[model samples]
Target chain A: MAERKVTVTSEVGLHARPAATFVQTAAKAPFDVMIAKVDGPPVNAKSILAVLSLDVEQGDFIVVSAEGEGADELLDQLVEIVSAP
Target chain B: MGQVPTAPPPTLTGTGVSPGIGYGPARVLVLDVPEPEAGARHDGDARAERERAEWALEQVAADLEARGARVGGEAEQVLHAQAMMARDPELATRTGELIDRGVAAPRAVFAAFGTYRGLLAAAGGYLGERVADLDDVRDRVIALLTGRPLPGAAEFAAAGSGMGVTTPFVLVARDLAPADTALLSPDAVAAFVTEQGGPTSHTAILARSLGVPAVVGCTGATAIPPGVPLLVDGAGGSVRLSPPAHEVARARRVARAGRAVLPAVSSTQVSGSHLFRRGMTADGHAVPLLANIGGPRDVESALAYGAEGVGLFRTEFLFLGRAAAPSVAEQAEAYRAVFEAFPGDRVVVRTLDAGADKPLAFLPPSGVEPNPALGERGLRLLRRHRDVMNVQLAALAAAATKTSAKAQVMAPMVATAEEAEWFALACRTAGLASPGIMIEVPAAALRAADLIGAVDFLSIGTNDLTQYALAADRQVGSVAGLQDPWHPAVLDLVAATASAASGAGKGCGVCGEAAADPVLACVFVGMGVTSLSMAAPALPAVRAALIRHALAQCAAAASAARSARSAVDARAAAEAALSRT
Candidate 1:
């Protein structure tokens, strides 16, 4: 189990394209991706609306976590995708 | 269950399609399309190296074969019969042979496919005139290439009844693809609800046809899942899930039982309501009241609303907002079901109106302008996707023959008279009886006179016309006021379009939002429009308005409104005149 912290840096917030793209990327990977609000229980990474419903917008610090063989590597990539400012 | 059984509420409101009222228990049909496959990859060899090189070749043949299979049941043995080419063993074997030759799977598939397709075309003919066998061949080729027959909707049949209860209910979903939406049973389902679909989604159109009720674009539908004890009243666009016992009891109390139904009384026609008969002029000329139906659920509403017939039965809803296009036979079954619902009445179907305002991911995204009003859409999209249009028209034509209804095929977003002619010609070639055009573009309205001969009928789509005329963005809240159809300009366009149809003795109908308003019925009549088609619930008010008034008065009101300088002035004057009637 590993956790990666990244402040969502996509403009227009994580609700629209960024959120969808995030879910799509997460869903594409084999490992389970967990996304949550700054201080909330993580929701499934594949559900676009759920991720969006969390209301994690740009400039907000959010926690990304994963549990799998490549947890660290996967978290790094996920962080990279999320942390692009 | 009674020598004198009780009934449900005297009134039920829903997303009124085709404006009629049917006081029956909710028949909830949850239309659902199959979700995209779980496995997907971006920038990866989802396929092995052997399958990558000739992706083009294998893809094309596969596309055509899949297309053939998809088109199978749409209309007749003719159009979709072309889809049988998917099952063509030689085509498959040849393409497979190409792949075995080290040319790569994609190229081998595409290369062999290309040759076979050329043969089908050289011998079978082009889109409009292609023989049945050839068309199916093309469909199969495309279907195979696309991997799936374009992402569309389907049906969602609940596994079973819980609590030994067959209570009338309305089914709701996020959105239904065409395939799953097909599973919706007209007899069992009362209504439909969806959160993420537009007016053009197949589920919406099916709801309109089944005469069931549907409310789409609700968006938060996962919250309303299957097996939930829920109550939906489409007329009100509201749903009460797990209602209190009293509410269920109240709904049951208000429910009108017995599908056997009472026979029509001679007085029933004249006494109950005058809306179904298209409003009359003070002079007593009959006006057609057509229904602007989107899905099967709205069919019942359309009939109830006193719609003389369906005026704008959008066909594109079957394919839009999905992963891919629909097969011809798949489209045919849906079309047949709609036309069948309104037997003997006129059901004017517009070909798929995709692109601009509505886009499909499967198609290469043609660069859309910041404001799509000026971009390519409607007939332009049809021109580009001739394959889709051909199958749709063919399905409509086939469905018409099967349903025993007067199903006239038409085109959407016709900007030029030539476009009308081309669409009409496509319809005719497909064996559809009437090839008509929808007058949504200002250009069509301006040149209505020239466009009449090109079409069997003319339908005034006032909603878009007003938007375009006023340069208003329909989605923009600031410009909401400008979307008024009563604008003298929109009315004049209707009048002009009507006049054009009248001269040629072609059918003229207005199935836009303007037609649904009770106050505007008279004005539409006055404008020389042959019919006023609208959503079903508006029928009662529209019928009452028409019955209470006369055609001469409506014409007079239209004239005064038309003389107004602006849309605002025109609406004001029209409203005042309608109040008097």
Candidate 2:
């Protein structure tokens, strides 16, 4: 599994609109993607509710993991969204 | 429920909560979802069960999307978010996992949603509010599997698609749940008819705020046939079945003329418009008209109605339906949301008033008493759980620092001076400036002087006060007749509390259904109550009523009402006195 860690930069955090946008992007990929608060169990990245329930706020670090073809590309995109200020 | 087309349609009478006239085909709302039997296993084929769950989810998602499209605005956005929730991948995956474990599709869906509901509820703030939304989605999916009318299905279909009843309809129901009314299309609903509800029920309040005609507490309303055209006379509190065309036209003509006089008052308009003015009686006695809101979302309506301040900010939204009490930070954030809305204005917040009608699953009193209403509730529960009270006060105090809004903290169900004093000290300890006690119990009202001496202010909750004084369960339909704030006994209590507050030179306010009544509002002011807080929609009517009557006229009405023999006589006397003036 490919993994990357990114700090949430959106002021409203990784929930609400940001969470919806992240899940919409993750749902488009052919491979499975998961997101977790740093040192926390990963939840399905494609699930808006699950991503929101993570309660990831700005300045909080989250670990993104995925496995399969194009996993690295997916990780890069998700990490960019998370790290976007 | 069959439609009877008699020559002259029977006119069923009820209590009119909102005033308007409407005519349309009936759209019955079914909100109750039968509990899925426990331990029901799916057929051995996990794939088939998964297919069933997926189908139900897709149907619900499509319905939500269609409704969102129909009602374009903030409501549309909320519905779109609900659609995303309906199609949540985590929920689907969990349901599949449960099916794989031999659970039936319905039970699997229920259990899967339960996990997320608890998580969201426990989060306890913005996320906590979404738990109700998730429950709506869950109920819809389950209803699809069981082949039942989805809760609010009639209205959703009517508004969303052209296939269902395309015309606007009169919404009839036993009662409406928050989920059913949350995103309703005001244009699609002609009026509201419910089997049970008072002037203070959610249905009445929502109807009035939306400017839709509503008649509540109508016996046999649920039995009205679906799609039958009915004439609703909101002012008269009557629903006429299959009315003659001429009769409907006359009603419409009357409504049109009324609208001509009050151009700002319409079924779809909400702003206070021409009525937006400072709260004062005809003689310029300043009695600030305020709003009673459940959360920050309601602050807009309060402001739109020109509320001087928030008189009762019920904090139960933070605690209701949650697995645990909200953390101090979460509570502070919620409080701040409301506080920031009314800078420099008074925002009186009631500490969590749970028990009886509204019980927190987390706060359990020692064994259930046969009657929970009289059991541990309000200040009693908070006293037993002192930590909860302290944390809430601390949060309020912290939030007050962020905004210029004058935050006054109060305790509900305070029956004694000691309880009032205890709450007052607790507020001071938490650094909150103003501490108050709710005058809900008869004992508290009777001993208002003592309680007022112990607290900074007194706010009367006439709903519970009437119930306790009359010995009628507010929730029981059979006893709803007895739950009348107009009762001389209840009036006496209000007069007692008001005089006590006046004697002590402290502010007193009435924040309940009683104060919402335009005529009664004047009476409360006459009795020396300094302020009135009620649902935002009621503000305009109450203000107009107050402006029509002078201070002396109001005082005369109050005394005349007090001298009346019964609740009926009290209302009559007050009305007669006002009319004579």
Choose the strongest candidate by lDDT: 2
Best by TM-score: 2
Location of the lowest summed lDDT over 10 successive residues in candidate 2 chain B: B262-271
Pairs in steric clash, model 2: none
Q: Give the per-residue lDDT of model 1 (tens digit) for B1-581.
A: 00221332322222323211222233323222222222322233334533443343344445444443443333222222222233333445565565454444434444544554454344321221223233334433433444533211112223111222255445555555553454345555566666554443445445645656666555444444345555555445555555667776665555333111221321243555543354554456787667777666568777765577788887655764333467778888888878888878888887777655555434433553566666767888778778877877777766777886788877778888778778777777888767888888888888898998877788887767888888986544346567678777788788888888888887788877677576777788777788777666555556666655667777778888998988778767877776673
**DockQ, candidate no. 1:** 0.01
Q: Model 1: how far is B305 from its true place, Å?
A: 3.5
Report model 1's interface C-alpha RMSD after superposition on the true interface residues: 20.3
Error of 2 at B388 (Å): 3.6
Question: Interface Cα RMSD for all candidates?
Answer: 20.3, 4.6
Give the clash count for each candidate: 124, 0
